[model samples]
Target chain A: MEILNALINITDKGAGFLHSIPALLIAIPLGAAFLAPILFKLWKRLAEIITGLAVTACLVLAIYLVLFLGNTPIVYTFSGGNWEFIQNLLPLGIVFVVDKLAAFMLLVVSILVFFAYLFGLKYLERFTGLGKYYTLYLLMFTGMIGLVMTGDLFNMFVFMEIAAISSYALVAFGTEPEELEAGFKYMVMGEIASIMILLSIAFIYSSTSTLNLAHLSYAFTQMQTQMASTPGFRAGFYFVLILLMFSFSLKAALVPFHSWLPDAHPSAPAPISALLSGVFIKVLGVYAMVRILYNVYGFSWESSPEVFTALIVLGLASIIAGSLLALNQKDYKRLLAYSSISQVGYIILGFGIGNLFALIGALAHILAHALGKGLLFLTSGSVVYRTGERDLGKLGGGLGKYMPWTSLTYNLGALSVAGIPPFLGFFSKMFIILGAIDLARVWDSDPSKPGWTMIAVAIIAGLFAVVTLGYLLKITNQVFWGKSEEKRTLKESPFIMVFAMVSLVVLLLAGGVAFFFWLKPELLGPAADVLLKGTKYGELVLPGLFGAGG
Target chain B: MLILGISLVLILIGLYAIITKRNMIKVAVGFALMEYAVNFLFAIIGFHKVPGMKIIPPILMEVKTTANVLSSYSDPVPQALVLTSIVIGLGVTAFMLSLALRIYNRIGSFDLDEIKRLKG
Candidate 1:
């Protein structure tokens, strides 16, 4: 009850004019990305130190922002707040609104980014031209935090482009023919998705005449009520939403739009891979889509049942197809990449159920999958760095004897991702199942009759958790354990790499219990409330929507 | 509606080129075509038939802002949005073209088929 009180009973607290932190969050990374090359030219070591400091600073600000956020969001309007003559509030100019949901996402992005930077410090030492790599990497980092912070639609598009373009460069950073091939393919698909997203933005801006998210929500709410009866307006309105969904799904790598992921993810260096899988897809794709659909458009299961239903269908396809395909992979990294698709399917499914419990489940899955998959990828990097081999069949057999830290952490990650007990992933999956069951109960109009379809969805979702175990354990059975004909000289990774992996595992272990304790009130509850409250977000941002549209 | 129809046609053309053309250069060209189409659509969104919109730019310091300027602005917000979007497109294009050049140096051909070394 106390924990619930923490989430529910949030006061503005003392952080009133401390609103400039949001701008600093974006500027720190952007400044670092631009300065990295010059700093490298002056002293090779200095560039990385600056990058480290920048990422750490961002993390500090994000943590402070979330705690300071309590319940009411921190609204920072660029240029508008600094000048009085302009007279800008929510309706005008670019706004950065960091509500509980955005703050939650901000914390997630900064955590993974900080660790990935740590892992990369040693991992990328072998590669030459370290300057540009750090530059592009930081840009990707800024792009992520920027998009998450922005409450303007066009600003979101711009940040999406920044992240997408840099990732394309980073994916091919190794410069091998195969890496180039993967990068090229990823660029094409990503650009296509970008154009589609741009088109969707244009369509919305044309209709609403406002790009600010709060105003769009106000305009959309008014439209949903007033013009909803007009068949022409309704169809066009829905078409815009569907277009946005398609473009973001392409970025998210959900089933049909998934080809780029397996190629792009594994092709990048390990830390970059971790960033892409653990955070990129979620922030740019899932996070952005959820923001538009729920907050901006004020969609819910009740308001827009078919949209939820469509998402459920997509979620199921990705879960089944991704898990089934991963079972056949020989490359360990590729196999992990495929399962990312499967896990994302689970997250989307939880959201598609579109109930409060389901939302909590979905948000938990995002956090779990980020930590679990991130740790898995970092471990994969350790293996590759030491052996320079990625093939599971060729690289394998009884390797755990040598690399104890890597092996131990890998097992914990696998166990967590595979949804075993006492780990964060298990709780996330458990919450989703409970949510599905809750949804099923509500799905049936008659108290006497059970909702058969939703019950099946619950069972199917639960079974896939086991399927997650199946593919992940293949790594244990094949790569970590088993006898080999050859005995090769193997060593545990450097202390730094091991340290990075251990930190993530520590997060999965202690963080799981902490999340459970803080579960209802502090973190996920208010964040989920942002979705459940729906159009209330617009009202919160801009009170009295009366003449606000004009 | 005519402008929207034209943009759709351009989009279809771009998609066709991307899907059917085997040359890497042609694929980049296809992407540029789509970018142009999308940019054009956004800019046209700003080109209202309101008087003085074409003759006088709306961002001038002299012009007094009106709340209803949105529906009536001759050249409005989408124009600025398109400019930013176009610059982003330029960044993406430069990256893609440089990558293509490097790929060409290694393979000695710009064939998409040759780039398919990674297993599906």
Candidate 2:
């Protein structure tokens, strides 16, 4: 009851403005990125120090927003007041809207990025062109935060391109022949996806003369009500929706569209591998799709059966294929990359289930995978940093005995990812299956009637859950605790590297335990409700719909 | 409708080249083709034409007399959007071209099939 009152009180103060908080989140990192080279020229180590300070500041701001905004969304127009003044003048202008979900993603992105930067501090010592690397890193960082915050469609596209372009450069940052090949492939696929999305945006802008997300959703809802029976309108509308979904799914790397992930992820440096696997796909792919499809276009399993069914099929295929393919990998990072694909399957599955618990489960899985896979990748980087080798066959032999910190953290990550208890991944995977069962029971008409489809989905997911455990265990045994191989001068990683790994482990443990006690109900619940509320999103973001379509 | 048809045809040609071509440079060219097609589509979307309506460029020469500029001219927002999109596309094309050159320098082949070093 107290929490509800606090939430209402926050929402009551809806048009809260606090001195340009939203713009600074994007501008700080971007300014830092642009200035990094100049700083590098001035002093050798000042660029790194400034980047560290800037990212930490962003993280602080994100955490502050999560607490201060509470549950109500705050929309910031550049003019520092309510959007009503511009509502009558220009139909749409640059707006930054931060709601529960956006806040949650900001938190996740900031946390991961801060740690990734810390990890990169020591990790990039041997690499050349350190200034360019930091520049691209901060640029990608700015792009991720901006895409989530902006309330304009074309703005979102621009940020998406910024992130994509930087990531392509980062993937090939290693500059090996294989790394260049992977980067080129990733760029081509990403370009095609961006073009499709832009084309769809053009279609939307043609139908409605506004590019603002709030106005667009309002217009869409109005149009659907007015022309619900017009076949031509419906056909064009669904066509646009289909194009948008296809492009986003390609970015998300769902099933048939998943060729680039396995290649791009392994080719990058470890911290980047962590970022690409952790938040990049979730932000640029799944997050954008969910916001546009569910909130703007108003997709529901009942309303959009074809779309939901396609999602389910794609999710299932990714799970089975990603895991099975992971079984045959010889390289360590490649296997982890394949595992990432399968875990993304779990997130897609949760989204397709289309209920509260499922949404929460999916959101939780995003955080879990970011932490677990991030820890695993950083550990891989530490191993490579210690000894320049990556093959499981050549690099075995009781590695745990020498590096206790890496071994213990790696084991914890493996257990969590495999969905073991007292760890975060277990709860998320369990909630998704439970959500599936609830959906199945609700959809079935009679009490005694059987729900075969949802039941089969749950069962298949559960079975593959075991397969996930098997492969993780196999890899863990091979990498950390196996027969001795070639001996050399190798010790635990440097202090800074171990410090980053330890911090991740602590987060993983706290997140898992906090799942039962607090975070599920308070944080994830509100975020999921934003999705569940659907087109009511318009009301929350934009106060009125009268002048939306002009 | 004719403009839309032309855009689709342009996209298909680029798709065919991207799918069937073996040379890296050809793939890059195909990408450029697709970029222009999408840009052209955005330009078409922003355009408005009535059969008898006068066509005028969107300029503010007579701001007081023609305050309601929207009714007098075709929309220029999509034109502005396309301009920005085209510049970004050029950046992507240049980057892709450079990457292809680097790959050629390292692997000594423009054929994608021969550049099969990192496979399962």
Candidate 3:
């Protein structure tokens, strides 16, 4: 009897803890972010400090949650206080969930935001509207955290828009002509994408009669089996999926849909650019794509040939197109932005290959890209700060003479991103290539099919690898090694900016060195598991209080 | 069905305006209109034959006690989603307007041709 009572108590406590996970991570940041603008009125510096503290607290909590929470999912639900109908349709109310995958993303996003905020302390001094900047920054941070944490698909869309909208405003913070133009173009495209996403969601809800992601996944599976005879229903479902993929691809800035990125990333302030390239696109675009495709749709490259083909084609196009575009860019930041597109292609290719090693490689590359790209953008920001020049042609040689630390950090970042050995990028690329060869071997076993297609794709990916190295080397040599014709003197950027860049460089090196020791178990392993057992997500997410009735 | 038709027409008009309008401001306005059409479509998709759909969800006890309310209502999830979508639209619209204003201030003209400062 004593043992039975103890078991009952344990279950009760587990239930309570699971319910609180979302409120702890999402609600706190969201509330703090909303109140920050008002708090700024009392004390400007106080507001910034408080926002940073909240994000740091969030990061610590996320790490703890990831460590302690078992494989089971956590759900948090909120019902309207008085309305009876709303309680029945819990989907109408706000809901948040933090599963293993989302919690891991939360950790990455919080770390990036924490550093960006620290960097912003000094970097944002020249820009007007300090309070407004912090407020929006925190708000965007809150949205990103929420996006990663939420369990509801519609809620995900809401958070996505919140982050995207803030990013559009942040990009044009300078109010310069080019900034405004880029901001406008980005806003228009973003709004259209949101519209497409909403339309898809509406269709999905109408079809499934549920808004909860896990519940919808179960419903979709049921429909897939039951409606096998109904061609129209299948067609509608596929159409919604396609719309979703298109919208997310637009946000991800995948090859054909990436017209706005090169302009917007360069136009934004450096910290914002870092946040945009480092975490924003990943969380909003890549993360969502992975979550929806793997969790909700139950896609596997082996099972879903069409989906796999689409992913590979898109990946190849982004790789070749982004590289070719970067090859000719003269502006310093624009070149980096184009390079981001190419690197994102690498991540996509790794994921699409759908092998265990390749998926892990993709997640690892994501971390490396974030650090490398973040460092490079910060360095570019410093260059702009010291000289007020963005055109690479106008920039003279021997930038390292003035700022040796920045030059070294920037060079390390460039090398890492170019996939040089002993860096994080090299290991990730090796894994992807190995996975590709494994996939080719598998295809070859089937004598009816041709392995040439995958072989060609792999060759193209390798060629872009070289192109990436070429441009990065060219930029590094031109900026840091060449002599200036004008004979101008340059000074180092603010201490805070240099610190941020160096810190990111250290992380890039550390991540590369400690990939197996640190990153694999914490991030890559869990992410790979999530994608590998895609259909099992539905099983894990169901069986909760608000779950679909079996 | 009528609402769907209207939304389709509005979307086509918005696309035309975005493609043909020389003024950047007008193009932005076109995009805004297109967004509105989508928002309307979302609202319509969530609409049900029954009336008195509650936007706010009630407590669990009330849900257990109430019978007619649960059966005679539309799904409110899409409406809530649309509210969020509308708010996001507003934020983006505000940002786009500000960008247009800044562009005018910088270039002294609202025409796309005049704001050709950035070259490929």
Candidate that would win on lDDT = 1
Docking class of 3: medium
Candidate 2 per-residue lDDT, tens place, A4-62, comes to 35534433435433325677787789988988878989886998988998899899989
Tens-digit per-residue lDDT, A1-550, candidate 1: 4632342233223454346677777878998998999999999998899999999989998889777785667776655344434333345666788899988898999999999999999999999999999999999999999999898899999999999999999999999988998999999999998999999999998888888888788888778665757898888887888889999999999989999999999999999999999999999889998888888888877677888888888888899999999999999899999999999999999889888888998998899999999999999999999989889988866888889899999999999998887888988888888888998888787666458878998898999899999999999889888777787889899998999899998888876788757855788889999988887777777653433444
Q: Which ten residues in a row have the lowest lDDT in candidate 2 chain A?
A: A10-19
- Give the proportion of true interface contacts each model preserves, from 0 to 1: 0.81, 0.76, 0.73
What does chain B score (TM) in every candidate?
0.82, 0.85, 0.78
Candidates in order have lDDT scores of 0.86, 0.85, 0.79
Name the runs in model 1 displaced over 4 angstroms: A1-17, A80-90, A446-450, A544-550, B50-56, B59-73
- Tens digit of lDDT per residue, candidate 3, span A1-550? 4743443453343575545656666655776777777888898877787788788888788777778777766655555565434432344356666777777787778778877777777777788777677767877888898898787898898889888888988988888888887887787677777778877887887787787877777777677675689888778878898999999889989989898899899999888998898888888888899888888888886557788778888888888989988999999999999999998888888878888877887777777788788878888888888888888877867788888887898899888888888888887877777778778888998987677777787788777889999888777888888776776667787788788888887777787888889778876788678778876776665554235355
Name the lDDT value of residue A372 in candidate 3: 82
DockQ, candidate 3, comes to: 0.60
Give per-residue lDDT, candidate 1, residue A347. 91
Best prediction by DockQ: 1
C-alpha displacement of A331 in model 3, angstroms? Answer: 0.7
Q: Mark the regions of model 2 whose C-alpha exceeds 4 Å error after superposition.
A: A1-19, A79-84, A88-91, A225-227, A446-450, A546-550, B51-54, B59-70
